[model samples]
Target: MKNTIAERILDFLKGFPPFDSLTHEQLLIISKQVKVSYFEKDSVVFGQQEALHDCFYVVKDGAIGIYRDHTLVDQCDEGDIFGLRAIIRKDQYLLNAIATEESIVYGIPAKLIEEVLNTNIKANRFIIASFATNTRNPYSDEDKGTLFANETVLQPNASSFTEVQSASFSKNPITCIPNTTIQDASLIMSSSKVGSIIIAEDNKPLGIITDKDLRNKIATGKHQITEHVEAIMSTPVITFPDTITVAEAQIAMLKHEISHLCITKDGTIHSELVGILSEHDIIVIHGNNPSVLIKEVKRASSAEQLKQIREKAQGLLQNYIEQHIPITFISNIISAINDAITKRCITLSIEELKQEPPTSFAWLAIGSQGRKEQLLLTDQDNALVYENVTDDTNTKSYFLKLSEAVNHKLSIVGFELCPAKMMASNPKWCLSVSEWKSQFKTWITHPDTDKIMLCTIFFDYDHVYGNHDLVDEMSDSIFDAIDSYEIFLNFLGKNALTNPPPLSFFRNFLVEDSGDHKDQFDIKARAMMPLVDAARLLILSHEIKDINNTIARYNKLSELEPQNSDLYNSCIQAFRILLRFRTQHGIKNNTSGRYIDIDSLSKSDRLKLKGCFKPIKDIQELVRVRFMLSQMM
Candidate 1:
């Protein structure tokens, strides 16, 4: 029988992949033969161009730095597989690996790994993923497709990676003579259905006439119809080279305060104009401009159009994430777009009803939208706050009809009906302002599971489409109620600490043990939601409002609590890494980023994840002491 250490190694190896497909007995046999090696900090494991070792390594402890031509390429730590590139390619080592810290590693014979792979299909896939991950382009790809490939696994999660690329612009541009009349330019624009006409001389763009130019310059009597194109055109057109990315194009438009960019062969007007890229062209190709999408939402009469637009927004989200754009900025942009769509839905619903709203009412985007941290399409959590009425039944009936239309429109626009029916259309949610304040008071005074659930969902409310005063009044009442009952914060803090971060008893990963999720890590409950929930609870305790995003809340906390600034700052850093990790994992596996298959991750990734647990551990300890909740559990 293999010793306990070998069996333990085999068990871990079996869960992770290429080894998972091997027979238990065979793996056990091989594990026993594995040689354990130790290296001091900065000690060279192998040098570039060195002949390959007989064995490749699995990191047991600490980190190893991989360098190509003396430039660091990657860091490998626990559970990481390294030195196998040489074995795989059957070439000399192309990178030098040195210990980043005192480290222990298990050296498995190259022959054994090959033997394991000979029969295991799953193991073979794992090997392919490992190679693909390490060699994937750093500039072009973000490790989005290297994890898993099953359709069932890929659909539920939303990611801020793996975006649909912007459509390539046409290179051959049509130009016009610089001295053409406004009349001729109008004819050209009519024939083209394009909003702008680029005026050029000798194939070089000189100026541009857009619909705006025609309206403001010609129609408004700033210039005559018989005038030269230059008289009615905006001079010195914005220009970019053919190599501009979709993102760069968008930025250029915003930066230079111009709509049409003359695509010049050399990116300067002195060069020949190859093509003209209009703002409308960008809107059609990219589908993400907030203003353009809002207009599309307004015109969309069908559900499918809204769905396609929403799906395109997901791609935009992925790009924002990859660019390392601030999550707050992403959330604001997405929420503004989402809010516009919702407002348009309300308008459509009112039109469908053939009756205006009977009284002033506010549509509240409760939960994540209220806190403004909504990054994924989870569900529609909302409510309604209406002006008080003498006849409750008549008011209720009027608003319920309006809400039903609004809710239906929202579903058509890609917001799935809230599973718990926590929606405006539900009578229980559509309440007068006084009633909502009473509800808040009750939840605060009598805290229980149901009350907690209600508080958790409702307290993070943002005014979606409503009377501003009603929302402000609601907010005032809520803070007043909380001020009267300070223990509400304690209750919230207790709830935050409920699901302690899932570090195992021995400080290893506590993976899901059975069922469909067996051998996978619960990233949501174990990692993400804990941080999110903790941030919400912490922010609420401080009586802060409208900061729902996890990382942003931590950043605010860092500023507010300067003495514990390091802790809050670490939380922010940890949350960013976790968010990025989840996004990359979700994009790769096409899953909801809630669970992670441990075997699919390389040893280095596992170590990086393990590093994230440090913040989770420290923060949870802080929560315990601050809340003084030793007796709660």
Candidate 2:
């Protein structure tokens, strides 16, 4: 069966996420099984509450308008996937899928999706994250102690283990040309507030002169102050690359009996001087315990300095995981370090802008960082919300420039730019308070697959900096929209069930079949997110706000539903175990803690993970029954 349509569908599917995570052979299978369908302009593909289509759809041409009731929720054009949440839940379509113009779509079978989910960890994760964003509900009423549960309950561990944390150095080193006079060099150092200056010729480090050189060589009349710096400088300077660690820095300084080390583009002395690491910097590294690291982050003058401190923090993280510290405690510490770095970057960016903001704004950390569940360094996901202004144009330009500066600095500090460009720097994500409210309202009221994806990301935002009132207002606006559109939670509830229990019908662990993590389990998608999504749906139903962490949300759920206390407790325990397990895997593999190699686990560990799946199944059943999801099915 040679099918050109399937080939076209495969070509289109390969370009999108979840699908892109699948294999060529797998996609070929899916594409061949796909049912091609067409719709005329303004024709309904599927109506709200219609029986679930056996397959989900991918738009091939024109656009599909997903609607809840009469309101258009989201518009999907080429390569966008829709109708999947319903098929996954085995439920009726929550929203109508209508063609905005003449269109072609490929309906992928639920069976194929199940096969892909079971065999592809990346695809599975993409599906789960797509469906279940912002599933943790923060507790309402500002009980600061409960709001940040770990800060209130967990005691900070005194770091007994000190590894070779990398040394932080100033990258924008002071420099002078070889012909520059000694007095001019001293003036350059004075103005730049550096203790040493490198003398370079053609961007290559030739020599170095320090305050000591002025004191020992020139001040003692070894050379005239007005002489060229090359006359007084130390030739054949010691150099190390930026990757040099604290121990290496210390040994280098001691071995050479030098007070400064030139950080060159390459490790060789012939390379260009990019930075100067001095005895003072080495001393700072020794002082950088976790608390000292926090202090350093606060006082960090540049993104590169913060990047070095963050690297040290990663060492701290590795040590903590090896020591088997509580996952909650580790997350709190890492999150605090991350937040401090973000705040510092924001502060530095503001200073760079050289102008006060036109209005109050709140910078938000969304997704994993918002839930404070980030264990490894991941891409930055953030948004900006400013107060309403008479003329939004100037205000938006100011904040956009501010965000551009902030996002750039964050990238420099090792928080990679988000691949999807969901950063505050993006014009779509940077909005005024009213505009944000409207944006949320549209998503909530319309409630489509695309809108749901946005909801998952935007809903879990935690304020990183700026005005608290703006964040609070945004929160209030979200609840208000959800209140008016109460059925939206049901749609979210169905979405939460998108990634069903991770176990196969035979009770074997479901692992990916191909790609980077072939044969590895995705603990994040299969085990963790089910609980996270359940918590958010349950909490939002109660209109509770502010509790973003999954464990904390479950704890609250236990109190809110005494009948379901045992289930919630089970979930809490499972979540904690899963979190620790993922953190350990991340440290072991030096990755983002998403995939798990099943063969690497012991028999007992395998059973423990399998046990976690039971609760996921149970909670999803609870959501189905609670929301009467079976009616849709």
Candidate 3:
């Protein structure tokens, strides 16, 4: 009597996104409406330039290979949807969708989207984002040869964005004993179809034999094929840790003039080899270069023009999100773009003055920007520090005018003024190096509710431009102040615990009890800020100055306190999830991603978000207990 087939489909769809975000009732409607189609191996579901299907597909079983020409573009397994983008556009399929194996696909009616998008803005945004991220084809011939073929929807994909990403290396690296014959190594390489093989003894890498080694040594008759691998192997193999990044790997390759690198456990020759990274891996990941956007920002003469570029960078962000790029890597890419824009704004402001700086100074991005975790365009939180001058009044006046100019330009380029007047132009924040140092000391030595809050904001400052020494001096002064007033860290720790973690997203208990945006969750204040405050407090306690980003700070904390490594690591994961959620909401609503409507989240999203809450509660408790804040209260 039950609609078991539809119920089964509903169960499958509930585990995936977009649908997972829908209510059970809405999803059941969609499930019952879905038309099931089966295809044999290598069967075409839709062909390039073919008329659009009335419905888009979800793979019920097996795999779908989406091809543009003969090149495979994407692989869609179970839970992956295809043909939706074309249906959304009401256009012909631009790429061929073929069943790579015998598959059953569920085709959901296009009207389901109409029903969903009409009432659900969250679903609407997902559909829009998918359309924006998936396609690259021109709408018309006139659009070609411009900056992008489809300038309207084109955003940089994750592969093209700047790389601070961990290299996805060959984890099961091909290895041979040092005494193995060169011919035997070559045969092993041929069977595995890998370009390189490591020469190892007792799991420790001794050397590497790349294809070039064979080409240069054996082919040139410098070494015989029957000779031992060690005889011709490139000894002293360049070894790096498993945590090597794409940029680091690329630099290492160029620095040592070697293509293959052995990833070891301890980043030392004596450590056990864990993986291998080669130039090809880097090349495959390289796409829309973040450096290209940075260069564009530098060339812009006006803030208005820079604003256009910033809009384009959001496309990159969307693409990165759609591609499921690592959140930390995405943050790094966006922050780099933001920093470049700010630097350009300063340059333009300086040009407007028609006079050089009166003294050595450093412009800094504080708070979120300082941490380089500001993925969304939000209020500017910044400051300026100049070298101390005898004629402080005139010097302050000059810098005030400069800061105002810079802030105005920054505003035009999309970083709006902070409502709290926490910006360089505020004069309160624009101070000489000595004055800034004194301010830091005051905040530390004589801490209070207000000063502690200010400390949270200002302590995360990162130099954006101008003289570097001024920023370094300020940092050294902060450590000095903290050392002099050791209890200051406990104050900071207590402040970090003020915002308790959410109970979970299942109920309204943790959301705003009364607000204009009533019942909305303040993800920033409640979820993200707690983690940010904890990371900053913990790192500051350790006297580590270099790590400003919350993720990086937690990473450092993990290294410093291996005893509490799991807690710190969990915090890092939770922070990343929260930050990504905030950015996604910001993208959807076109506002600062600080607030979230608790009701709109999909079941999958709520559960994913709920999983992150436990870590927050644990970290906050750790902060409360470690600082022994009961006495302070």
> Residue 287's C-alpha lDDT in candidate 3?
26
Compose the digit string of candidate 3's lDDT tens values, residues 1-633: 889999999999988766767898999999999999999999999998698788989999998877767745566778878887555545566688999899999999987877998877656555443332231221223322222221132232322212333566889999999889999999999999998999999999999998878977999999999899989889899988976656567556644667789999999999989999976565433323454456568768899988988987887787666556778878877888898999998988888899888888999999999999998888899999999999999989988999999899888878889999999999899999999999999999999999999999998988889999889999999999999989998989888888877764554438887868788889888888989999999898889996799999998899999999999999988988888899888988998888888789888888888888888889888888888987876
Instruction: Provide the lDDT at 180 for model 2.
Output: 96
The regions of model 3 sitting more than 4 angstroms off are 1-289, 504-509
Which clashing pairs does model 1 show?
16-599, 18-123, 79-603, 80-603, 80-604, 154-590, 157-592, 160-318
Query: Which candidate achieves the best lDDT against the true structure?
Result: 3
lDDT of 1 by residue, 1-633 (tens): 538889878877776445656787888888988988999998999987588789898888898877655544566767778887567645456578999799998899988767766666556545553332222221123233222221112211222112223324656555578788899889988887777788888888888887767867777887888888978777888888876555456555644656668888899989988887765455344335443355556666765666776776777777666656555556666777788777877777778878877789999888766766666766788889899988889888888988888778778766888889999999999999899889888888888978987887787788888798988887777778888988777787777777777777887788888999897898767876667777877887777776666777888988898998898888777776776677667656656576898888899989888877778878878877888777675
Give the range of the ten consecutive residues with the poorest summed lDDT in model 2: 132-141
All candidates in order of lDDT, best leading? 3, 2, 1
lDDT of 2 at 7: 88
TM-score of each: 0.57, 0.57, 0.57
Native-to-model Cα distance after best TM-score fit, residue 137 in candidate 1, in Å: 37
Each candidate's lDDT (Cα)? 0.72, 0.80, 0.81
In angstroms, give how far residue 204 of model 1 lies from its true place.
24
Put down candidate 2 lDDT per residue, 445-519, tens digits, no spaces: 999989998888788889999998999898899899998998888889888998889999999888888998899
Q: Poorest 10 consecutive residues of model 3 by lDDT?
A: 142-151
Backbone clash numbers for all candidates listed = 8, 8, 3
